[model samples]
Target chain A: MILPVYAQVDLTNGRWRKCTISAKLFEQYLGGKALGARLLTDLTPAGLDPLSPEAVLIVNTGPMNDTGAPSSSRFNMTFKNVLTGGIASSNCGGPFGMLLKKAGFDGLILCGKAPELSMVVVEDGKIRIEPCPQLQGLDTERIQEELPERYGKLVIGPAGENQVRFACAASGERVAGRCGAGAVMGSKNLKAIIAFGTREVVKANPEGFEAHTRKWVKQLKKHPMTGDSLPRYGSAGLVSKANASGVLPTRNFTRGRYEHYEDVSGETLADTKLLRNSGCVSCPIRCERRVKVKGKDVKGPEYETLGLFGPNLENNNLDLINELNYRCDLLGMDTISLAGTIAFAMELQEKGMGDFGLKPGQPEDLLRVVEDVACRRGPAGELAEGSKILSEKYGGADFAIHSKGLELASYEPRKSVGMGLGYATANRGGCHLNGGYLALLESVGVISMDAQTPKGKPELTVFFQNGMEAASAAGFCLFTMQAMIPGILFKFGPASFVCRAAGKAMLAARPLLSQIWKCMPWIMPINCMLVPHSKSIALATGLPMTIGKFFTVGERSYNVERLYNLREGLTRADDALPERLTKTPQEPDQPDTVVPLDQMLPVYYKVRGWDAHGVPTAKRLRHLGIPLPEEG
Target chain B: MAQVRYHGHLADLTGCRQEALEGTTVAKLLDQIKRQHGAEAYRLAKRSHIIVDRRSAGAEKGFRTPAGLDSLVEFIPVCGGG
Candidate 1:
């Protein structure tokens, strides 16, 4: 049962307010930026400092939570961004988002500063604000360890305590770190959020649950993307795939193809030190690979982690990288942004900028710097505010890959024009969590994209952005979207409201509605008239809702977060890729080729309803229930 | 028409995972193999810097076969492991 009507439960004046949004609004603007846009406009004030306690940090779970949504681990957190001073919202996948729903909490919105260090504990159907001196200033990994095995953790490290501009909220080894959200958490003097609940949020139908899960799990097992390849090789497989496709970013985004990528693929991991396969809770596909060095088991970093720490740094030492990754995780930091910042320092050192006090290919020296980064100590530490800060201090804004202060994820945008647009306009800055277009660019090749040509890329990118937004808002896993489609099966869960959300998502096949209706003719007997229903709340909760109503709520939440960015003073200029993708095609590994991004961006913006400057139009916002408030 | 044998990684690269591919043009063979096996697994054509009878075949370049189209063409994709 929903603790309050609709998925959004607003707490104010010690009473709960239930909001029912329309499905049209939900489909038009789903999750992440769209939800953030609505929420921030409503909640954020003008010229709000992102690091101030006045920053409204909303941990919003997507519509897909509590359903057997495969790879539906996505959830959003919006705040005044410390990086680009724009509207910022970061999405991530882990147990925390799922647990929030299970605990009967849709999302957590905490405003007003705490006088001292405190932790939010949700255990056994109760939420309490408690002080925890011991948890203060602890690194993320240590805090994760302190949590009972049954509970999920969202904690920050010394970077947050130091108010490092790029600090992240780490859960297990995954993170929602960017735009100093962790620093926002720290500014509130909040230490951690430990959540535990006994009630299982599995679907109401046990037999349907078993059959549905088994069928999808079987499909996943058979689909080459997940079964044999990703399960065994993990994301590391992308190293070679992108390299072969001529888009592996190497030597600090100078080239799309890494001549040394052979040294980093999943095949290399399988041949070398890969110790075991790992996975998230309730995940049938084990995509994480556990590696060992000196007999110390370390969480094997993903492709994004490897892209930055390995090839991006010009460091090819595999064994040493294992230890370096271990140090990052133990310190509770996001390796992607960390590597991006370090790469900036390395570029500075190579160009006779006289050592930002760094040794480019030396993993051991880099390991020492990890602690300093997390704590913002010493030379490289000061710029550890993030990659964009390092770029501003140095002279390589050309190479600094960030949007709104958050560094880019591991995908080389030069190879995937669609992905490049996704990175450029992501609400939380350069982030792949918004949408990963590599499946179309290199793996599945479903979108008929001339990846090397940039033809139709902008339109394709816009399509992916919308589809991903809808899927993630429904809270389903994205990896599945890469290979298969998540369809009407979702309506049985919170994600099903998007069944009609297809108009927003550009699909290869027709919409799920047509497909479902067509299948009904085959599955059911003749002369059956099935009527459409509104976005109804769960029967267990007895709350009334219309399909049109829920999406409006979802879109309203998105706008509020966008306003948070506007309050932070972010503008169109803040939403774009570095010169590597825009002004110049990345220098080809072959010595004379270009990624052709110039041929892409204009087309991308047209479909997105954004101006060439990358700002969403007033017409666009009005259609999606996003109110544009007065600006500074 | 010329035939190329699929072996080891190439076998995995081919749709059959064991059988060789037949084609008149080098591009056709590679495209056929990739379509069946999936592009993610067919990167062997680039990785294995190969050699036919005597001369070298460029890693990614497509080429015509020898006069004797029925000759036993060699499968020499570059094979390296760290």
Candidate 2:
């Protein structure tokens, strides 16, 4: 197998250089976020502004990308986070990653500012920086439409151009939607990136890889969560379950239960608005929902957008959510941050703190405010700074729903305490997937784990965070990780005694799991069918991959990002949820409903082999094969 | 009598979104649904996430959990993450 090659593009000089990664580095960091993190650490200095021309943006693909692996079309963009001023990595599923690999590059490292509005084009391994001043101020869709159809496109819109702090980069309808990668692109005056090539990705054990992938695809198809729930209802399927479990954010997270939840639910959308179901390339679990917006077909809202824009804002119109989702994507903005920021602004108006012509359940100004945010126009443009900045400018820091400057996803973690812990400790601010998405086990998935208890949450969070980080770095969709939970468990259902018993058993086995995680990778050398990721990597790259090694890579990846964040001056205090989640209970009568973040944080640090200060110890770093930073 | 609500496919199976049911406990509620809708609807409803008075029945005593008058028993279909 060929080692990964990265193209270093100097936008200012309009020159590029190809650098092949060493086998040692490839085996250690793998690709995607892990590789990007390692590269960023080496190339960037501490305290550099994220929205400066000196900021580095790495668009990367993993070994599995374009290799016919299920959900292998996913790619990652890593840069200095504009929202948090920490290490930022965002993943997206689209044709860009696949075509980039085909164009003979595993990644693109962009630096320096372009002399003018520009587009980077790579065709059959030839790279060029072409000025495209005419594409200025266009929405993401219009920019893509202007580009050649055959080239896989990654473009930014007006929000990115305006340097909205929560801006995102668009790849077709999919997005690298969190941590403001688009602002970094716009800082470099990059309007778009297009790649096209026909090179085939070669695997070390092609036949073995093919057979394993076939079986993996079959298992994914047979699994209840991947096959039925996701494909049928998309990620929005979690709406009813989250609401039923009291984790749905309502009225800007002041309450967990929404009175009119049924009106904005996944079932309602599927029944009323859905045109069809779609997905990323090579993915059997087609979880994308297609719906009509203003007589044109577009992507539907995910659970985050639906919950945050619906009940969180006291709105029950599902059609409005569809329009907002389409509008946000077109304008190159993240729906989670945008909705979260809007909700914060509405609450500020309610408190008579500051009015930005926004209110809960008021639809008259919703579309206009959204457009103004993207264009950075008038009072709504203040919202472009996001909730953290708004809270600083005004008051109500206690109710500002963000951690480390990045806004939280729609899961009202006051009820799902483990998810709250994940949100607080997640490397990339308040990302659910990065924080382990424990809500899947605690409230939404087959397991009905004790949501309020912090008893065994730390260990479980570490295990999940590591697993997901590795899966993402390997270029598989996070949805595939659902198969790790046996399909038989889903058959039992959440109400079954057996299912409840399984949840308890997992918590009970925390010590054993922790020990296993800390032990050497050689402890579990065998490849298991339950987790196809390790075997897939072993076959594709001929690397000595195992379940234990796969997790270690995840652990290494997470630690690398944490180290980068630390280098940027992030401290233990940065790992925190707002007072609304940590101090206030969702149900006033239920004092224990609040996320016991204090109780969980110490345990979480201990489980992660970090000191009480939450700084990773030298022993842990050495064990993970990461070099201790100079400060350490 | 408790107001029992069904969500998603469960509502389609039971042929109603909500109704007043004669039951003092969750087990009795399932039996009532069985008599009203059919055995398949009863089975599906049994597997659902039951929320009584806005709290998960799974967090309580499951089918044996009490459902008094003015209780709102909601059966929500199980699904995966966002």
Candidate 3:
């Protein structure tokens, strides 16, 4: 089997070199975030400023990328965490990953600041760092328009150029939309990277892989979560479910339910505004919504944008949200961080602590504020620093609604305590997907596993975090994992006795699950129908992969990231939520409404084989084939 | 009398967002919904996640859970994360 090749580009010297990882290491890391994390750790020093010239940025693809696997076109970007000051990895559904592979490279390792504004061009295994002063200060769309349409593009906008703390990198309309990757690009004076090639991705067993992928795609199409609900409503469909489950963030997370929720709901979007549905390359489940914004069709807001910009701001207008989503994307800003920052600023105004000329339920100046934040102009410029810094400058740290300096997603974790635990313990700080997204089972998905219960969450969180980490490294969309939930469960429904029993059974079986998780590769020898990723990887890459080994890779990935974070000086204390979420209840009469993070932290640590201080044990590292700090 | 709400596709089938219905329990409220709307609407409602007074009905007693006179009941379609 041919080993994956990576391009190591030095912006300082304007030179590049080709590098390859050993087959053994490839099996262990499995590419994407895992491989990126390992590469970043090896290339950079501890406590290095994420935006410094010395810091490394790795944009990479998994073995499944560009292959025939469904929703397999995802690429990952990893750098030092610009938000949390730890390890940062963001995934995007775009053509760049496919094109990069076709260009005879699996990844790019970039270091040093360019002497001038530059764009890296990769074509058929050759690399060039060309000056692109003409593309400076261009919005994401304009930059892409200026480039060749046939080439896969990854570009940043004004927010990135200005170093907005939550700026994102865009590839088409999809984004690696978290942890300030765009700002790092801007700091390096890199404007964009474009690639084009005609090479084909090879598979170890093409026939078997194709058959497996076809069956998997069929399963996704038949599943209720992927096939029907997602296609019909997109992710905005969860607005009603989140609202009904009392997990919807409202009024800056002070409340759980929104009176005007349906006004900005997925149902409403589909009924009134939807122009069409779209999807990423090689994806069978097309969950993206297309809506008309200012008479032009653009990408619609996801649940995070809708929840944060809608009920969290007390703004019921759906049209306004679509416009905001488009505007943020154009500006290369992260909507979740931007909206959360705005909500915090609004709350500050409410408390009379400061005046930012923004208020909840009053969105007249929102458009201006969005631009101001992107440009870092006026008082709104303070918001460009993000909520953590704003809270430190102001005095609302208690209600800041972020963990490890990154703002939480839309799910009001006070209602779904498992999600709350997830927000607190996630490696990337407040990322729902990285936190195991237990909110799926607890609040939104067909399984209704007592949203408020912390009983089995720690074990489940570890299980899912590991699974998702591995799947992402394998280059599949997290949405594909939704198919793991059996169709029979959806038929029974959440309200049915069978479904309720299953939820309870899961919680009751937590100890066994925890043991199974701890046992690792020994417990699961075969690929599971529920999880097709392991088999897919084995068939595509000639790797000896199984459900057990797949999860072990995920665990290794998680630990490697943890080690990076630890090396960067993050500790157990960094795994934290704001006081408001941990201390204050959403409902006054309901004492149990708050997130009991303290109760679950110990259990979570223990389940992950970490010590009392949340440090990965030396024995655990050795068991996972991970080198210790000194050894590395 | 309780305020019964339909969300997502349910509202399209019921032709209204919410209305006052006579029921003392969630099961009874669902029955009232079926009587007012049709079997299809009822099936959708049955499959949905029922919320009473901002809490999941499943978290309480499922279909048999009590719905008081002033209760605000919502039937929301199940959905996945974005």
DockQ of each: 0.09, 0.66, 0.71
Give the DockQ of candidate 1. Answer: 0.09
What digit string (tens of lDDT, one per residue) describes model 3 on residues A1-632? 76889999999889999999899889999999999888888888787989999989999999999997988999999998788998899999988899998888999999999999999999999999999999988999999999999889999999999989999999999999999999999999999999999989889999999899889888888888889888888899999888877888998899888999889999999999999999999998899999999999899999999999999999999999999999999999999999998999889988998787675566867999999999999888889999988888888998888889899999999888999998898888988999999999888888768877789999899988998999999898989888888888876568778778878988888898778766789888888677889999999999989999999999999999988888889899988998888889888888888899999999999988889988899989998998998898
Candidate 2: RMSD to truth: 1.4
Which residue segments of model 1 deviate by more than 4 Å?
A1-37, A200-211, A435-439, A442-448, A485-568, A587-599, A611-613, A628-632, B1-82
Candidate 3: give the clashing pairs. Answer: none
Clashes of each: 45, 0, 0
Q: What is residue A468's positional error in candidate 2, in angstroms?
A: 0.4
- DockQ-better candidate, 1 vs 3: 3
Error of 1 at B55 (Å): 20
For B1-82, candidate 2 gives per-residue lDDT tens digits of 9999998788899889899999999999999999999988888788788889877777777788899999999987777755
TM-score of each: 0.77, 0.98, 0.98
Question: What fraction of the true interface does each of the listed models get right, in terms of native contacts kept?
Answer: 0.00, 0.57, 0.67
How well does candidate 3 score on lDDT at residue A364? 60
Off by over 4 Å in 3: A359-361, B32-36
lDDT of 1 by residue, A327-359 (tens): 766665667777887877777778976366787
Instruction: Score chain A of each prediction against the true chain A by TM-score and list the results.
Output: 0.81, 0.99, 0.99
